[model samples]
Target: EGKKSLNFIEQIIEEDLQKDYKKEDLKFRFPPEPNGYLHIGHASSICLNFGLGERYDAPVNLRFDDTNPTKEEQEYVDAIKRDVEWLGFKWAKECYASDYFQQLYDWAVEMIKNGDAYVDSQTSEEIAEQKGTPTKPGIESPYRNRSVEENLDLFEKMKNGDTPERGHVLRAKIDMTAANMLMRDPVMYRCLHKNHHRTGDNWKIYPMYDWAHGQSDFIEQVSHSFCTLEFLPHRELYNWFIEKVSKPGDFEPKQREFARRNLSHTIVSKRKLLQLVEKGYVDSWDDPRMPTISGLRRRGYTPESIRKFADSIGVGKRENLIDVSHLEFCAREDLNKIAPRVMGVLDPVKLVITNYPEGEEEWLDAENNPEDESAGSRKVPFSRELYIEREDFKESANRKFFRLTLGKEVRLKNAYIIKGEDVVKDDEGKITEIHCTYDPKSKSGSGTEESLRKVKGTLHWVSVKHAIEAEIRLYDRLFTEETPDGVKDKEYLDFVNPESLKIVTGYLEPSLKDSKEQDKVQFQRIGYFCVDRDSTSAKPVFNRTVTLRDSWAK
Candidate 1:
């Protein structure tokens, strides 16, 4: 056995351990704002932190950076917890930024008294205008020189909701001419009168993410605060704020950046996803077409598949767009090993065996999953009349067509060899039924020589009388464009795939009737599918997880 190579993030930890870092001092945290459901993009961060926690046997806290009250909600907080737990990682503690509001406010007061922070009375627009670009230094607010007594009094009034929401903000008194724009007196707290989800109306002001994030990590003593690459510039401010609030000897949490993994043809932005839900583009946040963790779960994605994907891609220093096909490929691979094989025809065409007796039926032995020996077998009813895929049969086809064609032989999966003889069509020339003759001695799994005969194609079928009808929802990419967000001229919504979902009635084997919600199965030659939550005794519904192969490949 060989030791696994470390990713860049792991290498950083290893390097730190070799230097001033202690093995036991390694604590980590996954901080997410409870503004929306966790998306596929968050999956990487969750896996990385949780993976490191497992690697070092360190405590990893599930911390909510729930600073703003307007957008944050307890619903999203609960959803986030469910998502992380579903990924199979347990958090050491459930913490929230709201829990540290009082401490943070106290620290802000101390910073003000020390002249490291001040209350800025400028409107948000005016403040933004003062934040000079990359080459230019920002203009310091006139109030930046306010007396500590005046600043303290004004900030206290702001916290008490006595000021207008846009009137005042607490800013760190860092260098106004610093090269990093984020270091130029960034806002620490903003006066928001909205009620906090956890604190209720206890406090009327909220700390900015930049202010609360690093300090919360510092307070919890998290050794590494890993954030996406966009936060790279904020590391200075992150450290500075921690320095202001910490003693010289205290351990500080360092903010490190990793490139975000983007999925093609999908938007991970919560704003856009919210628009999708609000505009009726999707049913809800958990719509199967969405990339949210709940959406993927409802869409039949197994936790094992998602974790495998996150682990396989690892973490990268540079951002790259991953084709959704690879994710689908992962799902197919995982489902193949676990999903029970069943017969289903989404677009069925009736096939009547001419020589077989009309009322006769036999229960044949069918393997549940050939990939697993212990999966064993089940009885699948075979009858005179069966349904196969409409595309499987053609009155005539070229030599390349291995499926059922007139005068050609094809084996019915788990049944007998059948030769297409004739077809019955409507007056409009649409195929209504297909008639075939089966070799009785050619029953599959029988020791008879005819049963051992080879065929170019094998087609899955369900007995017409014993089959159960189901509603199948075939899912596709949400956006038609490869990079929906990259287009400058059009919005991501403009590229929404109109045919992303297609509902069809399917003929499924009788055994599937007993399948409960969330039960996954491979529909033999069709694809992988799971019983949706909408299933009932009268009508079972299935969601197509992914195609058996990538059909969209060029």
Candidate 2:
């Protein structure tokens, strides 16, 4: 095998391996707060951690940082697990921060006894005010000098629910004058008198994220705790808590930072996504227009496509907006090799063969996927009357137009060559049906000389008698702006594209009647689509994944 170039995160690991870290000591983790569905941004991190595990033959843990009960839920936890597993990686252990709450509480008590932590009686706002600015020293809390006995008693009261929810909080006794604001006596625990998803109502006080994260990593003996660059400042505090909890010569985890890759036209913030849901901008978390993993899945994006996207973008020291087309390109590249080609006319206009027998129909052999011969072929029904895209025809078109028009011959895919003769219109002058005549000798794939006749266009169509109707959902970008949240004075929701979703009934070839939920297909001349989970025997529904090519390209 060739020596592969390493990403910066891998280089950090290599540097560690050269130092005191052994290959056996390599352990990584993907810790996500279970508050919402995992988005495309999280995919990069998941791939990074799990990719590292695969590269080093180490174990990766799936740990839910479910420290906040007010926002976190078991549904989100289960969704995180499902999304991770769907991305084709397995965790060595399924862990949660709440699992070590008792251990963290014990450590806090020990820190109080050693004067390393003190219970503050001020409200959270007061504590924040005292944190001060980076250039100025923070004011010390009035309860900074509380006795160990009194601190322990108050901490117990906070834990026992005897204190009001905002009454007392435990703060690490760090330097108040530290330049790093996070180091200025950061709150380690706060009172939250709410029922937890996992540990229902047994405790009142919960540990803060900074207090729980590094300690959980230490407890799990995670060798490298790689988080987003936002946590670079938290590294000092992460280590401080780890040092206070670990004894001399004990395992110490290293914290590293990586930049987040944001997708164009999409806001990766969970809070904003929740607003989109609550504001009725989207139907649900798994709405096909959403950027969430389940949403992508429902939109016919393959697991391999997502992983390829993550790896192609890779990790970096700086963040940038990745054009959503690149993601669509990845989906097209994968779906092309797998998704079967089917004919589904979204805007149907009738076409009649004037000479062909009206009562007769035939099943024609159609290649399932021209890109994959092993995918075999399927039978598509054809008859005298067919439905083609309403935009595929014109009474008179210039030289550049390749589709059907008066006196211009075109091939019916997998069937026969036909030429437009006349049109039947309604009282309102709308072209109701196009009348055409077929050359009987030009059946596709037949060994006749006429069958090989070159035509400027090949139109996909479904037999009028055999066509199945399906509810087709055409989706566009959810937001109009490339960076909806980046603009000043405008909420992301203000940029929501009102035309993101358009629903219509489509006429599909009979070969698609047997398609099950999640089955993907390239609807010839239209776009890629998938059978939605909501599809039933009587009412089939399909979601448009992406267009055949980048439509937004300039």
Candidate 3:
């Protein structure tokens, strides 16, 4: 039997199946801390964890490791769920670490009673000082060997709001002399009177992430815990907490780490992303220039393209900076097949057909999408007075220039061929209007012999009388440097591209007047654009998603 090749994680699952694990027992989870909006880096993780569940026919839980009350919020929780669903994956259950507060507390008490944990009354700075580097053994805390009864009393006091915030902390009674600095009696819980987003102010002490993460997975009976490479060091602490709480015959959730996908020229750290938002470096988390999931969606990125990009990158053990172009390429590839083509002149120049009849209009056939036959076609209105791209015309040019140069003929897209004769300029010698003569017999698809006549250039135009006015936002890369965050000496904001966004009014075909928000279309010779949510019936706004090609590479 032919079988698909498996990733390392898949291979691990298959190996587990051969040993004792049942296919029905295969449960996966994607646990994201609800501190900030999910970014493109998180999209990769979402796809991976959800993809594993689909491949194994298992249930995947959407768990929020909302341990810190100071940062976690319902807004972030809602955004995370929306992002996960937007990526086209459904979780089996939406769980939160705070939901298991009582159970986790009871387990912490059990560990204390078992003489495997103790209360340490030390400042965070003091504790950090005692936690020696990897090259040296950490010094044991002064209160490490307190009797179990006293430790329990202190922990209860800490939880009952009797202790000041940061007065004391509960530490796992692991080896302080252990070579792994994280294993050297790490803190399990801390005193924080802050109100939790979910649990409220019912308790004072909260379990640390290392303490809550694995236990929550165990409580849900998750079989496979997938995390990024940064959590690899914490995996030891994750298992240590799980080992103390697990009962015999219970399924212990296994932790496996994969490298995080780093998109070039952008920062994905939630803290840094929050900084970007708070500092007003970007418009918002959903700004098109941002690498956030909402930003991508607003910028015309489809779920299919993102999922395809994740698949293309695949699962790797070592982190690598992926070129942002690959993502753009995927978006372009997906959009090219479905996006309807429309004529929109960003920099409009009036073009008059000198010989054409005045006060006359005609509708010409134009395909909605040339790549898809079933997309069908639509009628685009044309007339003697039309608007073409300002750069599409020149008074005089070499033979190599195929556009609307003097005495040079060019085909009007879906219309008749025309020859430029004269141009009207302003006082400043700026070209204002161009005059051209159209070949009446050379109408496109007319089936007449003149229709077969080939021109060196073709131009897209919109009838002046019927054209719709639109605000076009041209977006470029957010950062000018290839790796803005990689530079150690400078701030990431220093590399922000000042001209990342350019706004201009454009003339579009009348068919686009009714375009609703998020409607994607190709602006003929321009680029792929998405109808902005700010659009209204009177005026429409469009965001340039990506250019016709790799404009940056050029």
Expressed as tens digits, the lDDT of each residue in 1-554 for candidate 1 is: 59889899999999999999999999999999999999999999999999999999999999999998999999999999999999899999999999999999999999999999999998999999999999998998999999999999999999899999889999999988999999999999888888888999999899998999998999999999999999988898888888899998999999999999999989988778999999999999998999999999999999999999888888999999998998999999999999999999889999999999989999999999999989999999999999999999999999999999999999999999999999999999999999999999999989899999999999999999998999999999999999998999888989999999999999999999888999999999889999899999799999999989899999
Native-to-model Cα distance after best TM-score fit, residue 375 in candidate 2, in Å: 0.6
Among residues 3 or more apart in sequence or in different chains, the pairs in candidate 1 whose N, CA or C atoms overlap within 3 Å are: none
lDDT of 2: 0.94
Error of 1 at 383 (Å): 0.8
- Give the total clashing residue pairs for model 1: 0
TM-score of 1: 0.99
User: How many pairs collide in each candidate, listed in order?
Assistant: 0, 0, 0
- For candidate 3, lDDT tens digit of each residue in 398-505? 888889998989999999999999999999999889999999999999999998988899999999999999999999999998889888899889999999899999
Error of 3 at 387 (Å): 0.7
The RMSD (Cα, Å) of candidate 2 is: 1.0
The per-model lDDT (C-alpha) reads: 0.94, 0.94, 0.92
10 residues in a row with least lDDT, candidate 2 = 1-10
Candidate 3 stretches with Cα past 4 Å from truth are: 1-4
TM-score of each: 0.99, 0.99, 0.98
Lowest lDDT block of 10, candidate 3: 1-10
